[model samples]
Target: MSTYNNQETQEIPLVKKFPKLKVLPHVNLINSPTPVEKMMRSSEILGGMNIWIKRDDLTNSKYGGNKLRKYEFVFPHIQKKNKKRILTVGGLGTNHGLANVIIANDFGIKTSLFLVDQPLTHHVRENLLCDYYYGADLNYSKDTKGAVYHILKDLVTDWSSYYLCVGASNSVGTIGFINAGLELAEQIKKGDIPEPDKIFIAVGSMGTVLGLFIGLELAGLKTKIMGISVLDENLNSTKKLQKLIRKTMNRLRKIDKSIPDVSKKLFERFSMNRSFFGGEYGRYTYEGLEAIEIARNDGIELDPVYTGKTFSALVDFCRNNPNAKNETILYWHSKSSVDLSSIYNNVNYKDLPKEFHQFFDGTVEIDDKAVHCIRKKKN
Candidate 1:
C-alpha cells in the first residue's frame, strides 16, 4: 500500500492540539456502528488489492442512507433556532429530501421542499406522494438545478425562519463527519478493519466530503478520500464548496479562539479532488447501470444517481491505477432499497417499466398497520 506522503501528513495536526471550536448542537439521526465489510468478489472483479464496503446504507433510521449522518448535525440547530418550517432543495426523487421529511416529521417540524427536474428519472409524482404522506409542503420548479438556489433565496425573504440546506452545506453540518472520523478511528484501533489506503464516496454539494476530510485530519487517520462528483464539476460548485469550507474553518477557529494559523492549510488539505463526474449533474451513463446491477446481485442496494456513479468510478480507478494492486480501497454504500408498498399501493403496476418492476421482487411489503408501528417508534 502507498504510504502517506510527508506533505499530506503535515497538513493535519493533532485535534486536541489544534484550535478549539464551538460546534452547534445537532440531533442524533443515524444508528452508529455501521458495518465495514470486505468485498472479496468485487475486489476480484476489479483485479486490485483488498476492497471493502462501508455499509452506511444499514444506518438505523426509517429512511437510512449517508444523508442521515449529516442530518444528525443539522436538526439540533434547526430546533435551537425555533424554526417552525424547514426549507430544502433537491431534484425530484431526492433521497436527501425524502430523508429530511422523515426526520422533520419525527421532530414535529413542518417542512417545505423545492423540487427541480433533472435529466435522470424524474419520479416527481412518487416523491410528491411521499411528501404528502409525511405532511411536507411541496413546491415544484421547472428551472435548472442551479436556479433553485435563487428560488429558495426568494422564499426565505418573507419568512423569518431557519433554512436547512439539503446537504447542510455549512460548518456545523460538516462537523458530523468530524464525529464520524472519530468513530472510524476508534473502529480502526479496535481492529474492525485495517487502515484503509483510500476511501471513496459520492459528492453532490460537497458537505459530506468536506466533513470526512476534516474529520480524518481531526481524528488523525491518514487516508486518501476520493469524491465522485454526482453534480456538475464547474466553477459554480467549486465556488460554493470553497465558501462553505472557509466558513466552516472560521467557525472552528471561533470555537477554540486559541489555535494558530491552521485554517488555511486545513482547508487546503480538505480540498475535493473531483475527477470522475460523468457529464452534467443527475445524468447516468451505461456503466453506472452495470455497476448498479452488479451491486444488486451482490445483495447490496445502490441508487442510479449517486452510489452507482461512485461505484463505477471506483471500478475504473482500480483498473487504471498501477498502484491500486498494492492499496486498500473502501466504497461507501449510501442508499437504502426503497419500500414500494408505501409508494405504489393504489397505482397500477402496468405503469412501471419492465426494468423498474424488477426492483420489487424481494422488497418487503409494509401495510398500513406496519406503517403505524414504524411511525409509533419515532413518536
Candidate 2:
C-alpha cells in the first residue's frame, strides 16, 4: 500500500547495464535496494562466517517477497497485452498464487488460482484466505491431475486469461530476479554488504535461483548460488534449472545482445542441497525449525515451507564447512516479511468452499512435528 510500489520505473539496474532491456515492460512492485545487514548474533552463535542478509522480504509493504519481484515484470506485460485475467497454478496454500492475486488485482485484472494439495500448515491456510480476500477465483484441486483438468477447462472457458507457471518461473517473470541480481551488484558497489562468497536461497519452481544465478553472472560477480531444494528432485534438478536459465538468458539476449551467456559457468557456480527438504513440499523439518528459531533471535521471520529450510542449509554450511568461518556469506531472505495477523483474524475459513474447510477445521492432519507445533499456536 506504500506510494512507492506504484511509482514509475525510471531506470532499473538491468537496463543500466544493457540499455536495450528497457524494451521489456516493468512496473515497480518492490521498494528496491532492499536493505542488507550483518547477522551479528547469528554469526557469533554459529561460531563461523560473518553472515549477512539481503532483506528482500521487505520488498513491499502490501506483501513483500521474491514473488513481488517476479510480478514487477509480469503484471505490466500482462496489462500491455490487454489480458483480462490471469490463471496460475500452485499448492493449496501457495504464497505465489496469493501474491499473484493481490498484485494482479491492483491492476484491475482478475486472477484464477488452481491449487493442488500440499502438506497443510497454518501458514498455508492463511495464504488461502488471503487468496480469497484479494478476490481470486479459487479452485481446490485435490492433486495435480485435478488441477490440470481444471486448468485445461478454464483455459477453454476463459479466452481472455493469461496463464503463468508455478512461481512465475517462465522467461518473462524470471527477468525480475535477474534485475534483482543486478540490484545486489549495485548495492555491493555502494558497500551495502561485502561481495558474498556464497548466497543461500530456497529453490521451488527454480525461477528465483536461475534469475539470481544469471543476474550474478551478468553482473560479473563470483558469488556461488547455494540453492536449498524445497521440493522433489524431479522438480528441482540442475537439468531443469539449466532449461529455464537457457530460456531466461535467451529472452534477455533478444532484448540486449550485449548480455553474455552465463549458462556455461552456472554449473561451476551453482549447487543444490536437498538434505533439508525433509522429503516433500510444505513439510517442515527439524533442522528448519531450529533454523527458524535461530533467525527469530536475529529478528528475522522465516517460514517453514521455504526460507526456514533454506536458512537451515546455510546454517549447516557455516557449522560444517572448514572454510566457512573465513568466507563472507549471504542469506537472501526471499519470504514476505508482512505481518498478516489482522488479515488472518478478519477472514473466516468457512467463507471458503466446502472442500477447503478441512484445511482450517483440522481435518487435514499435519504430517511434520515442527509444522504441528505451529499449527497448534495458529501463528
Candidate 3:
C-alpha cells in the first residue's frame, strides 16, 4: 500500500492488527490520512460545539469521495481473481459508476456500466459523459431489474467479467471503511481532532457507515455514528445495517475463527436519521440547498444530493440540542470537492449516447412528482 502525501508503502494497520483475516494484495488508490480539520467557523456558527470535518472529499485529484475507500479493497480482489472486466450497476448519474471507471482505468481494467434513468442534473450529465470519456462500455436499461439481467448474462457469457453491485456495498468492498475507522483512531491519538461525541455520515448503499461502525468497534472507539439516509427513509434501521455488517464480519472471520459474534450491544453504537432525504433519492431539498450555502461560508463545497442533506442533519442536530454545545461532533464529508467543469466544458452532450441526449436537449421533461419540499416554488 502507498499514500500520495508521504509516498510510504506499508501494510494497512487493520491487516497487521488482525493477522488471521484474509486480505487480497492492495494497491494505493488514495492519499492516506485525508486531513481531519476542525470546522472552526461552522463550529462557532453552530452553538460553539467542537465541530470537525473528515475530508474524504479530497481522496484524489480527479475523482474523490467515500466510494474510493471501497475501491481500495474491491479493485485488488478483482485483480487477484484475474478478472478482465468489471461489470457494475447504478443510476444514470451515479458517482459510484464514475469513480469505478476512473480508478479501474489506472489498473488497465475494463468497466461496463448498466444504468437506469435518473433525474437530469449537471452532476448526473457530467458523470454520464465522463463514463464514456473514461472508456466504460455503457448499457442503458429501462429499469434496475433489466440492468441486473444484463449483468448476469454478461457474467455467464464472458467468463472473464465480474459483477460488482452498486456502490461496491458487498463484504469485500466494505473493508476500505474499516481502514478509514482505524485511520481516524490514529488521527485522534495524534491530537488532530478531539474524540467526537457523535459522527455524522450519509448513508446510501450502506457499506460506508457499516464499515465505519465495524472499524470503530475494532479500534475500541465509543463515538456514536449518525447515519443520515440519502436513499429510502426506511433503511435507517439497525436491523437493515446489521444484516450487511454481519455478512462483512463473517467474511472477516474467514481469516480468523475467533471473531466476536453479533449482538444487540454492538448495534447500540450507531443511530439512523432519515428526516433529510427530501423526497426521492435524486431530488434536491430546501434544507439541502441552505446547507450548501452555509458550508460555502466556511469555504467547503457540498453537492446537493448527498453531502448537503447529511450536513443539514448535522446542522439540525446542533439547533435542536442547544444544551449539548460543549460536546464534540464530526461530519464525514463524503462528496468529492474537486470541480469537473473543465471536463464537462470540453464534451458536447450530443456526441454521447443517443438516449442520454434528451437530458441535455430538454425534450425529456423531469416528472413533477420526482422533486419535493423546495423553497423555490414551481408553477
Candidate 4:
C-alpha cells in the first residue's frame, strides 16, 4: 500500500496556490494521515468485493470526526477575521456543534450554539453534553429549518460577533474535504487502496460532500461518491450539494478568471443517491440498528444518527448492485469517542426516557476518586 503525508506545510499557500482557489486562513485541528483500513468482515458479508473504511474517527486530535477536517479550513478564517466568538446552529445532539466547541476552546474563541428541538433518540447523548462542558453559550428554540435563518438574523441584532455556519457552507470550509479528495486520489494512484467503484458518506449540511466532489473532479478520479441523507427534508441533498459546489467554483473563478467554466459539468459528474433515509430526521430504523451492531462487532464504532444510517445504506446498496460486486467499495466512518465524564456533568440522567434507561443505567458510573459529588449507580 502507498502512503501520503496529510500535513499542511507552512510553505503551502494560505489558500493553496491554485489560481482559482479562494484562500482562507484556518487553524489546524485534525491530525494528519488518518489510517485507511480495509473491512474484511463487511466485504465477506457482502460477498467480498473489497470494502474499506477511512478512519477519520481515529484522527489523533482530541476532537475527531469529519468536522475537524472541515474546521482545518474554517478556524483560520475565524482567526484572521479576529472573531472573538462563533455562533452556529444545529440540533440538540449536534456533532458539528460539539466539534466547534472543542476546536474553538483550543483557539481561545468563545462559541454560542442555537439548538433546535428536533426529534432524536432517547438513549443517544453525544453532542448535547459535550457542548455544555466545552462551555458554549446554548440557546434552544423549536425552530424548523426555515426558521433557523431568521433565528440567526435575529441573533445578529443581539450579538455583533461573526457567525460560523454549520458545515461551513462556503468555499473556505469546502476546501478541507477537497484536500481530502486530493489525498485519497493520490493514495489510489499509489495502489494504497483499490480503485473504489463507490464511496458512501453521511450528508447533513453538504460541505464535506461538495468538497469531495470538487476534489475528485480536480484529481480526475472516476469513483462515484454517494451521500446518505440523515434528515428527511423534501429537497434533494444533491441539489444542496450542487449549490455549494457552484458557490465554491464561483469563488475560484473570481480568483482566476482564466479558469474554464466547468460548474455545469461538475454538477453532472458528482452524483448523490439518497434512497436510504427511511423517514423523518434524527430517527433510527431497524436497518440502522442492525448496521450499528454489525459495525460494533467489526470493531468499528458508529452512531445511529449519522454514520450508522450511511453505512447501512452502503451495505444494502452493495447487496443490491449486482454489477458492482466486482469492484471495491468505501464507507467513510465519521464518528468519535464520547467523553463520558463531561456528559455526566451536563446531562441529567434521570431526565432520559425509560426506553433509553439501559444505555446509561450502569454503563456510566461516577468516579468517587474525582472529588465531584457525582456517585455511581449501583448495578
Candidate 5:
C-alpha cells in the first residue's frame, strides 16, 4: 500500500537516464516499492538462515502478480502509439494472459490471446474463465507453429493491434523489472532487508530475473541470482536470459548511449537450477506442494505453478547447503497473492469458449499432482 518514497525513487539511475520512462504514458497499476519483509517463521524452521520475501504479490488488489509490473511499462507504450488492441501468447493457465486481459481493460484496449496447451489443472480452468470474464478474445493453438501463425496473421491483418511477446518479455516490459531491481536496492538502503546473498525467483520467460540481474548489478550489489525454471527442462533458461539481457541492454543503449556496456562478468553472477521443474510447465510437483504448505505456515499463498516450485528449490537449496544457514536468502514471490475464488465462482463456464469448457467438465484428463492440490483444497 506504500508508494516508494522520493529519495529512493530518485536514486534509481535508470529512471534518471531514461527520463521518458517517467514522463511516458502509464497506468499506475502496482503499488510500487512493495514492502520487503523477513520470513521469520520459515527462517526459524530452516535453522536460522536469514530469509526474506519481496511482496510483489500485493502489487495490486484487483489483479496483482509480476506480470502487472511488465504491463506498467508495456501498456503505456501501447497507449502512446494509440493502439486499441493487444495480441499476446501464453499457455492455457498463463498468469500473463489473465493479467493482460484485466489490466488492458482499464485502458479500453482489447486483449487477444493465443494460448498453447498445458495440463488442465484448476488454475488453468480458472484463468480460462477469467480471461473471458475480463473480455479477452481467445484462440487455442495446438502447437508452437500454430501459435506463431496466429500472431503473424494478427499482425498482418490488424493495423490497430500491437503484439506483446509471451509474458511481455520484450525490452519495454523488461524495464519494469529493472525498476523492480531499483526498488529493491532502495529497500536495502533503508534497512528494510539486508542485501541478500542470493535471490530465488521463478524464471518462465526470463523478464523478471533479467531485470533483477541488470538492476542489482547496476545498483552495485553482487548478490547471486538463482532462477528456478518452471518451464520445460529442454528450454535453455540461461541462454534465453542472456539473449534477453543483451536485447534489453541494446534498448537501454539507444535511450542513453553514454550508459556503460554490460560485460561477461555480469553473467557469472547468475545460475539456473532446474531440479524443481517436475516435468512439463503446467504439471505440479510434490516438492512444490510441500513448499506451498511450508510457506502457508508463514501465511504466504504460493500457487503450484510458479512460486511454489521456485520456493521448493529455495527449500532444497537451504536444506542441502548447510553452510547457507547463516547466509541471507530472498525469495521473490511472483504469484498473485489475491484469492480468485469469488471471481471464478461467479463466472459462467458456458460463457467461456466452448473448447475451454472441457477443463471444467472433466473431459480433459491432466497430471494428477495439480488436480490433487485443487481437490484437497475443495475437500
Candidate 6:
C-alpha cells in the first residue's frame, strides 16, 4: 500500500483518481511522468504529423524500459504473495529478465532466468554477462518446451518460487501501464504536449498496449493506440490483447467498483499491426533497421526487435495518412535509455556461465550481421 519515487513517496495518478485503489501495494522503479517532448526534426523529416515522444526509456537511472513501468505493480505483488524468487522465461537477451533481476534484487528476492534460444548478437551476449554480473541464476533452456519444463521443475523443487509469464503482462503487472496512461492524461491537461490523436507503441507480451488502452479510455482521452506487433500474431493478435484487457479490467474493478468497463471502446481506440513482426521473434528486419536510423534523427536509440519495428509502422501510418491537419502522433519510446557501458566495463565475458560463452565466442554467428550493425551505422 506504499509507493516510492526514489527516496520520496507519493500517490500515483491512478491512485489519486481512485482513492479506494490506493490500498494496492506498489513500489516505484521510475521517475514519474517521464518527459514528453515534440520530435521537431523527426516531424519535419517524416512530413505528415506533428510527432511527439513519450520517453519511457528513461524509466530509471541504471536500466530503464517498458519493463520498469510494469515492475511498479509486479514487485509488490511478488512480495505480497511472499515469493522468495522470480522464475521467468524469455529469449536469451530478455530485457524483462534483466529488469526483473535488477528490481527484484532491491526487494531481496532471487531471480532464475530460464533462457530459450534466440538469434545471437553482441547485445544478447552483453545481456548474458550483465545478467550474471547482477546475480541472476542463469538456466539455459534450449527452446520453448524446455523453458516450460525447467519452470515447472523449479516451481516443484522450490516451493517459495513462482513462474510469472513473460514481460510481466499479467493483470497485476499491467496496472503499471494503466498508471502510465493516467500520467499522460495529466501531462496533456498541463499542456506539456498536445493530446495525440494516435499513439504508436510496440506490442510484445501484450501488457503495455492493453494497459495503455484501458488507461487512456479511463482518462476519457480520445487518443487511439496502434500496437505494432513485435512478437508472433498468435500472442499479439487483437483477440489475445482483448482477452488480457478484460482480465485486467476485472482486476481493476475489484480494486475500485466505480471504474468503468471500457470493453466497448476497445475497437474504437486500439489497433494491432502484425506486419512489422519481421517474420519471427528476435530477428531484425530491413524496415526496422531503417527505422532505427530514422529515430536517430531525433536522438533516440531503438532496438530492432521491438521499438524499431514499432516506429517503422508509425512512419508508414503518417505517410499513408498524409494531409490530416491538426492530427498529432505520439511515439512511445519504450526501450532503455541509460548507458550501461560502466556495467559492461566492470564485467568480463568469462564470468558468465559456460553455456553462455558461445554467444561471445566465434562459435555462434551473430544474428543479422549484428556485429557490423553495432560497430557502424547501417548503410
lDDT for every model?
Answer: 0.64, 0.85, 0.80, 0.67, 0.80, 0.84
> Rank order by lDDT, top first?
2, 6, 5, 3, 4, 1
Worst 10 residues of 2 by lDDT: 370-379
How well is each residue in 1-379 modelled by candidate 5, as lDDT tens digits? 1132234333344576456445433456678778888898898888887889999999988888799888877887897788999998899888999988888877788999998988787778788888888899988886667999989988999899999988889888887888888788888988988899999999888888888888887777878999888776445455676678788888777767765665465667888766677767877888888888889878999988899989988888888997888788999999887778888889989887777777777788765554333222232
Q: Sort every candidate by TM-score, greatest first.
A: 2, 6, 3, 5, 4, 1
Clashing pairs in 3: none
Per-residue CA lDDT of model 3 for 10-75, tens digit only, reads 556566567655344555677778999888888888768788899999998879999988887788
Candidate 5 deviant stretches above 4 angstroms: 1-13, 16-27, 233-237, 370-379
Return the top candidate by TM-score. Answer: 2
Candidates 1 and 5 compared: the better one by TM-score is 5
Candidate 2: which stretches are off by over 4 Å? 1-10, 370-379
Query: After TM-score superposition, what is the CA distance of residue 171 in candidate 2 from its true location, in Å?
Result: 0.3
Q: In candidate 2, what are the lDDT values of residues 50-149, reduced to their tens digit?
A: 9999999999888899998898888888888888899889998899998888887778889888899887777887898888888889888888888878
Runs of candidate 4 exceeding 4 Å displacement: 1-23, 122-124, 145-155, 158-160, 234-239, 256-261, 338-379
Model 5 lowest lDDT segment of ten: 1-10
Candidate 5 vs 6: which has more lDDT = 6
What are the TM-scores, per candidate, against the unseen true structure? Answer: 0.78, 0.94, 0.91, 0.81, 0.91, 0.93
Question: Residue 140's C-alpha lDDT in candidate 3?
Answer: 85
RMSD of 2: 4.1
| TM-score of candidate 4 versus the correct structure, residues matched by position | 0.81
Q: Which residue pairs clash in candidate 1? A: 20-255, 20-256, 21-255, 21-256, 22-255
Tens digit of lDDT per residue, candidate 1, span 82-146? 77677777775677787888777776677777766555343434554566567666665545464
The number of the candidate with the highest lDDT is 2
Answer with 5 or 6, whichever has the higher TM-score. Answer: 6
